[model samples]
Target chain A: MAHAHESNTKRIWIVFGILSVVTIVEVILGIIKPESLMASVLGMKILNWIFIILTIVKAYYIAWSFMHLEGERGSFKWSIVLPLLILIPYLAFILLVEGNYIYDVYSESFVSWDF
Target chain B: MEATVNTQTEEENVWGGGNQPLGASYGKMMMWFFIVSDALTFSGFLVAYGFSRYKFIDSWPIADEVFTHFPFLHGVEAPMYYVALMTFILIFSSVTMVLAVDAGHQMKQKKVAWYMLFTIIGGLVFVGSQAWEWATFIRGDYGAVELRSGRILQFVDAQTGKRIALDEFAQPIEDERVVHLERNGVWYQSGEGLPSYTVNEIKAGFMANENVVGRAEKLNEDGEKIMLSREETAERLESAVHVVEGANLVRNEYGNRLFADFFFFITGFHGFHVFSGVVINVIIFFNVILGTYDRRKNYEMVEKVGLYWHFVDLVWVFVFTFFYLV
Candidate 1:
């Protein structure tokens, strides 16, 4: 029992190390503005896609490791994460696409509306 | 004697935990619900931000230029560093909270209390820093022009992301100024001219200037104000606009109407979470010192609170990416 718990402690620390590395990657990707990455990938801006993916990955580690969700039963774990997984992406897609449309509407016609 | 019950309330699972220990209670479930609601609130603000970004697709102030403050490096032009630091602070505190819970499981009272104290302090610091960030954002950055139609027209270098100021591009104020006619006529108290600077001032500078002045038109590719050609820059020197003072949603030195609104709403929502997290953490810290969880022997309370603390850090990851990175 003692050895098992010790190994868990070691594993948690490893997860922390991974999270730190991921955050560094995010910061670097944000700052560098690499043209190749900035170009379109998978139908979205590559940089934007990178930011979203890295954020979700970090959120996953926080939940599974830091919150000890990994120890939870599959049902319990999926209840929280699955709902968010389905809902958040749906929201993001709706808002992002709608936002682009609004931009189209706003830019199409120039009315001297500024007074 | 062993007790057994054949009947289980059907609604137990609906309103309460069905299989879990009763004394485990439902407070943590309630916390999850609150987090869900909070998440929705943040989404609403971010969606609004997207709406505004869509509106000013071309001329929107780039996020990178507006948020370039870092610690100990005064005016270092290090954008996104503060939010990154705030992210690390929140996550590290979460680490301490989880350690506290682990210590609690081992019944190390002193260690638990100490770790909880550190976590509480971290939450407080994050909230305070968020306030400072908000203050800097609310106070204008690059002064802008409120066009006659209420839309914002901000100056940008044609090639550089660098923002052009109204003053830099505007003609200098001269002795031969058009003092408000209302002052002499006393016939009408007209609402103030759109801004303090007169059209004549902007025109005078544009007419006299050599540097290209960008005329910010509507976001229409054709409408967008391009820099005057080298010769046109000199000819249009008299009409060049200067930076106007005061607050209007359309024209802030920082960029657009959407940026300010979203910055306040998103950060304010996040700040509120940190504030409440601190309060909850303080309560838990006091309970640890009072040995409440020690008496319970299970130490589950600390674990549940640890979940919440980590959740706050999780939300910040997305906030930082969307607001600062993407």
Candidate 2:
């Protein structure tokens, strides 16, 4: 804990560099949108998957470096991160599945919605 | 009396009932707690957006086609460029904020103030950019027609496969079109003003234009908007109910109404956060100038606010991805 008092200016700029580079890459990939990466991997386009994963990487740098979660005690870090980690994915998973089901109903049912 | 005092001290040991259990101040810990809860609130809104998007997955608006405007680039197609710039601006501000916190750690008051000023300016620019984006979205590029089924139909030049504005093709029709207001109408109900061009004029002009075709919101297997053939376009024209120029809560020139709703709610909420963050940063800025933190011999207040600013940047990362990229 006492070692945290040292200057971390170098680390901060390094993380900033990482963030900038990642953002640039994401922008480039978005603009080009290569046909090869458009294939559906697991119900989503591979390009979309790449974007989400890169976003998570950027988020990790922001929280770990900018917010200084790296210096915090292990238990403290987990206490802050665990609930969000568990809950958000659960919520997204269930809701997206339900949404897909509704789409199935809208497409398959005899009822005509687009009159 | 000594035994009782010693027992009380033992009960309130460092890891037990001590106020600073994790070596963090109460205010800082509370900020983290608040951030966790706030993160959940934002995720809830985003997840709802995702749900709606999936429900209308086939007809959801393509982000690249939508956000293609730059600040001074008129009639140029540039997608993800301006938003990338906004992201850089925000991340730079986050950098300055962390630098301010670093300077505060070394008790450098002047550097902290200057860095705080930079952070505030960056936030203002980001918010201004957001306002511009909203305006551009509301004042859409090309006009679309709303069907009786509440679907959107866009006009495209069949030869070039490019979009054509309503003014370019829609012929003027002289008629007594009046806005429905409560004072003038007998029915005590009011609605929005009339569109610039009525459906009759659109149909007439569309019939005259030999190269223009209508495109539906549905996407084909290759992820392109399904374009109707000439016969299908003429048949679909009979179902036009309204001429939609831009986006609003109720309707949008974009494919889905839910897309506009989500775009407004999520970005509006995030903008509100940035606004409040600016206000808070300003208060702390003045305090730093007054040497309040120096007098207290602790720069933790600056650090606490830095946490919040970084969190704002963090949320924007997710939003930029979900809304624009994905």
Candidate 3:
């Protein structure tokens, strides 16, 4: 915490390079959208899985480097990251499952939504 | 003496009154708390967006087809390029902000000012780009028809698999219907502005053009919009209730109305944050130019603002992925 006088120019540029390279990779993959990756692995496409994972990776780097979470103490870091770690996935799971169920109901109903 | 001894004993305990928790300053800890809560708010919105998308998974709009326009390349089919550029601008601005914080740590006022200026410019550019994106989305390149069942039907060239604009095919009608304004239409209820072309004109145009076909909002197994045959296109045209030109609260030329709704609300909220962030950065930039932080013997103010700017960039990373890419 006391290394206030040290120059962090090198570290900042390195992180910037990493972020830019990752973004470029994401854009390329999005544009190309290879057929193999488009196939479903589990409930979703492998390509979509790749995008979500890469986005998480980018988020990690941005939070750790740009927001200086790396310099913070263990307890401080956990306090911020832990609650979201638990809540976001749980919320996503519930909402998605419920949404799919609703779609099932709508599709099976007698009324034809379209003419 | 007794009171002083008791106070000293209390100060030695683990829950001491004056100690900072987790070795963080009061302001820093509060900022972290705010960030955590804000992150949850964003997640809630995103999760809702995901829920709605999943509910209408079959009929959702493909982001690539919808956001294909670039700034200067008219009629070009460059997909995801402009958004990618915008993402880069934002990330680079985050880098500049972190660098500004680093410079402040070294007490390098000149470097901090320069880096802050760069960050401000980047933020302004990003905000401007978002405005342009919203404008493009509102003034749709091609128009579509809204069916009676509240679904949109777009036109496409069956041969080239490209979208066709309403203006290109729809024949103008010589009807005497005038635009009803607030004062002339009714005493209290104002009539909405009528679209340029009526449904009859579009149906006639579709019938006349042999190459044009109507595509439904639903996606097939290949994640592409399902295009109806010429026979089906003619049948579907009978159900056209309104000619939808662009996005509004009720109807959107792009498949799902909810998509436009979420796009507006979530991005609008995020844009508001970026706008406020720019205004804050400008004030801080002026302060740096005036040597206020220097006179205070510490540049923690820059670091604090840098945290906020980085958080904004962080939110955008997720927004870019969920809204544009995934």
Candidate 4:
């Protein structure tokens, strides 16, 4: 218990620092909004890249620090987090593609459909 | 504990075969599983929101305009500030909770009590702020058109895509249509009318006023209103009451009704958690004051609640990111 307390203090500060740094990166990227990268990426915009990356980083910190997964056993940590990592990404991919597909339908094709 | 569990054996146990690793208590383990499920639930919601956003990529409501409110600063155009403050308060409470748990370990009841008090206060403040936010959202800033099909059309200036209020283009309520005879809805339920005006009434008034045009929700290539612009939107809102009939779903002023519904449900759920956390903290605070845990020689109860408090903070982190920052 003593060990846990001592380590938790150190861990909290370390996590706080990491969180602050990630936040700064997000702000910088948000403000810059550079168009060169945004121009094209396999037809996906660069802004999407920034959003995805930052979101992933935030998700990582939440799982690792907030969850205390880092302190848990390797197998235990993997069992919980890895499953989510595997699933969330897949869900994101499918949904984003499907979303773009739907958007095309609504913006372009929806008008053609009669009531 | 391990020996006892092992001795109890598989015969006596249906739960986990009486074996568990990591030394986490039953309560904590269950909390973990519950949180995992809850996290997935939130992910599904956010992902669905994203999917819908992708479907209407160009025309979906901009988040900035939808969430602009700060205390005592009516119509100042301050966006995301209130939510940002709410985020900070939650984080600060997390810090205090950890401190309380730290003091709990050291057997300092007084320190634990003080820290826990601060945490409770923080949670209360968060709930209060959320209520204010909900009120602003429900009241809606700019009234819009409700179409028969349930989509929304916002009035905007013909030139600029900026949203126009019905009042701006709409004429005053016709006394002839006033089924009322008094200032308030007294005497008979003939009704003074809806407290907030609707789009249809504005449309009726717009026929009376000149230069006001109704615009569908979609924007043109220049990111301006496709049909209505600032002047027309303003004109309709100036004289209208209630909301556009079926158009209630796509409130021009508030964006999509689904957005508001989700906002209320999501943040309301979170606020409920915060409120309950505060209540639990209060109970523990009393227990601490009464020396219950102190006498027990272990403040694990406090530590357990701290875990929950921290979890609440963690959830808010994601909520803020997706709902505001993104």
Candidate 5:
């Protein structure tokens, strides 16, 4: 359990650089919002997908390096990460799909919402 | 009861108190449990935000247009710049926190104290930035008209395609209008403060200015706010009931009320977390200075707090992606 003899400062700086670079890329992409990527690929813009993917990468790196999950036993890491990995996406999917259905209903109804 | 003698070997006793499940200390395991539950709570909030956003997908305000202001830049249309900076500050702070934990592992008390101080400072800055962001969002720029159906109608230059503030063209009218205070009308029910311009003033202004057109909340094929034709603009203006200047629980100058609701709730909640994290970091910072952990020969307290700090940073990454970037 004692890591007093070894140095992890180099690895820490490298991860920080990686996270910063990814964030800068995300910001740049967001500002430019290239027309080609803005086109909807599967109900969402391709650019949005890129942002989400990059954000997940950043999240993973933070967890693995900063939180020291990478140094922990495999079972411990999985125990902490796997549940969120399964449940969050499932929850997002259900809410978004149902929300879209409700939107369709509003659009089709005779309420004349001044769209 | 046979004095409750142990019958099973340690290897066979899954619930044995002597064993560290998953090789984690009891404190670390409990922290993970708490983190998991807290993560689910945040996920619930984000999913609800997604649901509301999807339901009003077409009429949702463009995040870029709303969050364009930076601290020093007065009129520049720099979208996502300030948020990006905030993200960097948070991630860098997380780095500092890990450094503190590493130093703690090495029993370097002074280094841990300095790194923890940096982390606390970073957290305070991030929290302050979030407060500024909330203030900016609440006090909106370029006011809009709220229709009877609770829809917001903004104005844009017909030729330039740039948003125009109501103050630029609204012609003030001299009328015997008295603002109803708590002492005047319905003693128990006080009236809201008068908007900068009346709907009539806005309508008259729109009619007089040929260069200005009304933009509806809905988006068109190119992902731009749908602009109404001159005739449609006139028709829509007829339904305007009140002037919406900024955002609140009841109304938002930005298209949907739900957007403001989610924005306040989620970001406010996250800001609260950061605030508490700073407070905790400060407490730990003092402990490190007092050599409490140094005497104990372990700085696991710093490591524990570091885990929490990293979690906060992790959550912000998702919030930035979903709320701003996407």
Candidate 6:
């Protein structure tokens, strides 16, 4: 209860400012869609990579600041975040790779009977 | 006798009711667990969306073109602006929610109530904006023709390089079109409502308009829809079988049908979360005004709901990036 009374309104507002700025930057980039960023880096467009990275930044702030995960004990924080970090990317990777493989098959081998 | 005393103390200190293994209250820990599971659920849906997008990588709908409408700015080609504003509203609401939790920590009843009220208002506004967005999507802008192969072909004026809606240039024709009821048709057969224009009518209208050209769903290297030449468009027009005006489970004017399905499912699910969060916030807001936490000597209830509100906002950031930005 003693620690509960401590005020961190200033910090909350700062995080909010960061989130708003990040969102605005994302929107501006989406609108402009610079040609340089349109080029593919590994497989995805550089612009898409930028958007995903910014989104992760925003998610980190929302979890750590607004949700107060930073105040939680280290073990508990990891218990929550670690599962998501490990599982989500694994799921995304498997699904996306399979989908791309299917796309290749469709383009290279699967011939439509309509022709 | 000394050993007995030590055993009693150890019993009290053991990993039972008195333990705070995670340094979190029971309810808060449970809330975090629920949030973790819920996050995985959302990720499953998003990952599925990614799979479908990759499967149709070259012909996937351009999100900017699909979600171009803005409220009160009719027929204007403002892209990403409305969704961006919605994102701002949602994030602002999240700020107010966290502020309420902070004020609750300080035991400021009035401040907590004010912030909660702001958060609830923001939630309602976000839900309303999402509804409008869904409506705009279901009731499409530029109508398209569906080829026999389930590909969409949108129209653009060749000179101006802008989309032209079906009603704008599609000529009127009278026909004896009737909805097929189960009794009138085959024993188990029924039909959905007919589109405004038939395929022959569209073909006739397209033939009459010399400047209008068909834009295929496939994107070229530059990531723009491949615009067919006039002769190619005319040749492609011969295969057109149906007019697709808006989105539904069966079809959409958007390039990929799966895109509309994922859009409806994911956003609808997220909107449902925001709706429930508002309801929870209202309950807690009332409890705050009633001074329930004041008597309880803690505002942990508010903190729990704050966690939830922030979680919703967190999910939206991903949705915005994947659905709209990327």
Q: Each candidate: fraction of true contacts kept?
A: 0.48, 0.79, 0.90, 0.32, 0.88, 0.93
TM accuracy, model 5: 0.94
Pairwise lDDT winner, candidates 3 and 4: 3
Model 6 TM-score?
0.94
Better of 2 and 5 by DockQ: 2
Candidate 4, residue A57: Cα displacement in angstroms equals 3.1
Tens digits of per-residue lDDT, candidate 1, B1-326, equal: 11123124433464564644332236665665566666666666666676666656676656676787665676578877787788888888888888887787677899989999999989988888887777666554555654444444455565663666667766767665454675588776655445545656656655565453444533444223444354543343333353455343444555455666677767777788788888888888889889898788656678778877887887788788878887
Model 3, A1-115: lDDT tens digits are 4444788789888988998888999999999999889888878999999989988998998899889898887999999999999999999999999999988887899988777
Calculate DockQ per candidate and list them: 0.46, 0.82, 0.85, 0.40, 0.77, 0.80
Worst 10 contiguous positions by lDDT, candidate 2 chain B: B14-23
Q: Write the per-residue lDDT of candidate 3 for residues B175-244, one digit (tens) a residue.
A: 7367866677566755666888999999889888999999998899899998899999888888899999
Ranking by DockQ: 3, 2, 6, 5, 1, 4
Q: Tell me how far the alpha carbon of residue A92 in candidate 3 is from the true structure, in angstroms, after superposition.
A: 0.7
For candidate 4, the docking band is acceptable
lDDT of 2 by residue, A2-108 (tens): 23456779999999999999999999999999999999999999999999999999999999999999878687789999999999999999999999999999989
Model 5 ranges off by over 4 Å: A2-5, B1-16, B176-189
TM-score of chain A of 3: 0.93
Candidates 1 and 2, the one with greater lDDT: 2
lDDT of 5 at A2: 38
- The window of 10 residues in a row where model 5 chain B has the poorest summed lDDT is B1-10
Which one is best on lDDT? Answer: 2
Candidate number with greatest DockQ: 3
**Residues B220-286, candidate 6, lDDT per residue (tens digit)?**
9988998888898888889998899989988899878898999999999999999999999999999
Across A1-115, the per-residue lDDT of candidate 6 in tens digits comes to: 2443688989988999999999999999999999889888989999999999999999999999999999888989999999999999999999999999988988888696222
Show pairs that collide, candidate 6: none
Q: How large is the interface RMSD of candidate 2? A: 0.8
What TM-score, over all chains together, does every model reach?
0.78, 0.94, 0.94, 0.79, 0.94, 0.94
**lDDT of candidate 2 over B1-326, digit per residue (tens):** 74465556766785566544455778998999999999999999999999999999989999999999998999999999999999999999999999999998888899999999999999999999999999999999898999999999999999888889998999888864867766776786656658889999899899999998999999989878988887888888899998998899989998888989999999999999999999999999999999999898778999999999999999999999999999
Model 1 residue runs over 4 Å out of place are A1-8, A109-115, B1-25, B156-161, B164-209, B215-251
lDDT, residue A30, model 5: 91
